[model samples]
Target: MGDILLRVSSSIKTLIPFRSVCKSWYQVLSDPYFTRNLSLLISNDYSGKTYLVQVEKDLISSPTSYSMKDDIDCSSGCPIGSCHGLLCFERNNSETYIVNPVLGSDDDLVIMLPSMNTETEVPSLFPVRIFNLMGFGFCPNTNQYKVVRTIRSTLRVYIYTLGTDDSWREIEDLPTDRFTSCLPGVYLNGALHWLTYPRIESDDRKLEIYCFDVETEKSHQLDLLPQLLQGRNNLDGLKLGVLDNCLALYIKLGGCFSNFDIWVMKDEKCWANIFRISGVAPLSVWNRDRVEPLMLTEDGNSLIAYAEEDDERRLLKHFDVRTGKNITNRTLIEKGTITSGRRYTAHVATLMSPKHIMKRSTCHV
Candidate 1:
């Protein structure tokens, strides 16, 4: 029976009912080893749903959507980060939640994480500077779930370990004015990757891809940041994504930003060029400025990308690597489904319970 559970562990949603049927079954499914394996979800046969978000005009609720499943609305904004099928959301600039949208409306679905920005910190006009540089990831070394929040207003870093730390604890060595984008860092191989803010010292100085190892809690930079080192448009050329569990870069060449080149990191510094898409590579007038590659599909043929339109709207597109034309209905997530500007984290469905992942409870049935 335990062997049967292990065999079906990959489809976590199927195991949820059995965990309640017997004590021994619950023990096996809840084992850290079982849940930890889910963290390595990226695979060649990847069929995980890529959830998008549409933040309501009232700023009240952001409905999480996937091209596959449009009705999966959760509590708050688009994900701050995603790992092992759980998506984290920030609400009202104060409350945060880690939710499994697959378990929609279930009693044990959302985990309300403790707030990091409280009102009592030495009052200044801008008392809340340390918001937005937040991310959620899985640390393989410990088989633990962690959220790393970098204070954008200041140079401090704080980390929260679920099922362990109830509060956000400060960590050292955070980069000042780096980790610029409020969007969650792309998680791959136990680390989060983000393109740093462009350097202004020289025209040749391009943006660097920064990485933070979730296990060690240390930060570093990646090499050959897929762009021409000397062009004025260099810094804006590269965008990040994860393909086959590896970090991938989408480079938009030329001034009009039409020609595209995709590369995936084989190691810390080694990048292997994967594709080059030419002519109308989904860089429409609406989605030119804000576009990102989501991932390489399971078949290893085309790439799926996310783009925000002109007026805080969003779209997801797929382009053939060889042709570079928009294959709107050819891929898994065919349409962008018109969304808000909120960052949409790639989501997969799983039954990782907050009760098992967090030490404390605010996630009630």
Candidate 2:
């Protein structure tokens, strides 16, 4: 019946929840044909009015021409990740919503989490804090969407499993004194890697990289690049990312004029360098705010940074990751003071979409 339905129509195939139909139906849904069709449907549903900004690139940003007149309230927050063209987002108030922008299919899945203060599910009293630094990744092994959130100062690990009806589960506690706010959590090698500030008072300046295995729920201490750790005398200045599939650490050195260095770890060896920004009068002009999300562009060859340029404007800067140079400088959108606090969203695709590939292919034409 599943195969017959799949042969009859793509629309009807999506109506049946493959995971719930049967083992055979699940296998059929995971088939290449079904998945590809699903991706196309998802892509078409999101391409309109929603766009991913290529930060760190030189592209002229257009002014906001269309307004959200209907005002489908997304005040909870904006959607960030899109899988099969379905966007996952949380409102500013932690109300989760999955929307297909093209199809206009917006489903709100609100789940209440335990409050740190009361430790109980209170109605309309305690608000759930949305950890922006938390990593969102889809686990294929478990066929589950896992959201890993680290409590700001305490290193408390909370995993929100989508399959478990978005229930919050408190995992093993890490060693105390782990201070991470807006810290990036890198998912690599089937584990979540984060820079941790160890508990030892004497080695307060020392920064340790810790890895939490998603499969085993175990934590292991990773060796920090000695060159990077040595310079991290102050905890507030270190930045983290993955460069060329390896751990990349950026350290801010304080002086009369500030200096920042980038270190990449490969096969347990660390390569360090100080990046120079061209067209800048003085290198000191590059402040801590200059570094952004460091995202991969639609082309995957370039890295993008989206940040605010002024009170009235936002800037998207693009860079070539291979050469460590700027490619394009584009502003995504600029708005007046009245719309200053409004949020915008971008989707990060794990699997390259054919539509995106074709869209990029047209660039040369």
Candidate 3:
């Protein structure tokens, strides 16, 4: 019986559906040992027409057996927040809910603003036009959760703590010129970073970054790096991620091939030009003119841009901070024909090896 339990433990998530095998099996499945190893994987349906997929990692390796399951139903305007093993999802009408699909739990959070909903219409003022730019993070110091929503470049910041009667409290209304289009906000080092493109009437295109601190609930500007300022069109690029915990901006410069330049913030007021990958090489080709394509891998270590070669679709892959490359022809995912043109979103995670999970249990037991 213990041997059977051990085998079940190796794939706890996959074995969950088969817990009715016997009483003893049920006991083993309900044990803390099994639940502790369960990993929650989440990805959004960019069209907001389908429910997000939340699957247990234990079953993912055996893709044939572990089919990905939809965990949460999402609307067009709902913003998502991920922390620990749960997601903070809020509708445009201010209906907030904390859901942990893996645990089959959904907790309704109270409204953050006191009289705003009844006194003034939220949609009229702060409409949910774009869901991609909303920023959500957990603050350990306050034992609370925070969300940042931008409306046509203006920012509305909200925070919610556990055991608090209020759902979200609006801290401030940020100016409109500080927010960028299609760029996502990242929460790191107690602050939220947003990429913005500000242009004056007679001034050249001044690309800037706006940062908001969760502690102080204040917004400040970080100095643009020289290389970032020199880029042909920084706004045309996409927000990659933070390198070494600093904000990393990926600029797409179009020439004979697509130019990818990475700029990292060196200091609060300064930035450093980190790396640049130019031209389509034997390993990786830049898709200079592709529509609705460009993927950041699950680990954030690789960038996959869709390109074409000899009438066949290919993906130009760059790994290890955009160095060491390969052109994989296999399609990670393929979708056809959609209704409304929604913002492009990517959600992927590295699937752990079953051998690694076995080793983890051996060390624990």
**Leading candidate by TM-score:** 1
Stretches > 4 Å off in candidate 2: 1-105, 108-118, 121-133, 150-156, 173-176, 229-233, 243-245, 255-260, 268-289, 296-303, 307-313, 319-327, 336-347, 350-365
* Reference-based TM-score of each model: 0.70, 0.56, 0.60
The 0-to-1 C-alpha lDDT of every candidate, in the order given, reads 0.57, 0.44, 0.45
Ranking by lDDT: 1, 3, 2
Model 2 misses residue 194 by how many Å? 2.0
Candidate 3 structure lDDT:
0.45
How large an RMSD does model 1 have? Answer: 8.5
- Two-way TM-score contest, 1 vs 3, winner: 1
Rank list by TM-score: 1, 3, 2
Q: For candidate 1, which ten residues in a row score worst on lDDT? A: 39-48
- List RMSD in Å for every model shown: 8.5, 10.9, 9.1
lDDT per residue (tens digit) for residues 225-294 in model 1: 5445643345455567777777887677565546667788888878888776555334322244455565
Q: Which regions of candidate 1 deviate over 4 angstroms?
A: 1-78, 105-107, 120-132, 198-205, 226-236, 281-292, 305-345, 359-365
lDDT of 3 by residue, 1-365 (tens): 63555455544335556567887666655443344334333434454433333222221232322223444455543544443334445555355554444434323422222222433424334432332345655454554445555333234545544333244465654435333544446666676677665433334666666777765667887656555443225455556455555766666544545555667676776666656666532211223233223344445555433344432332333334456355233332223332222333333221222122223433443
Q: Better model by lDDT, 1 or 3?
A: 1
Q: Give every collision pair in model 3.
A: 110-167, 111-167, 112-168
Weakest 10 consecutive residues, lDDT, candidate 2? 38-47
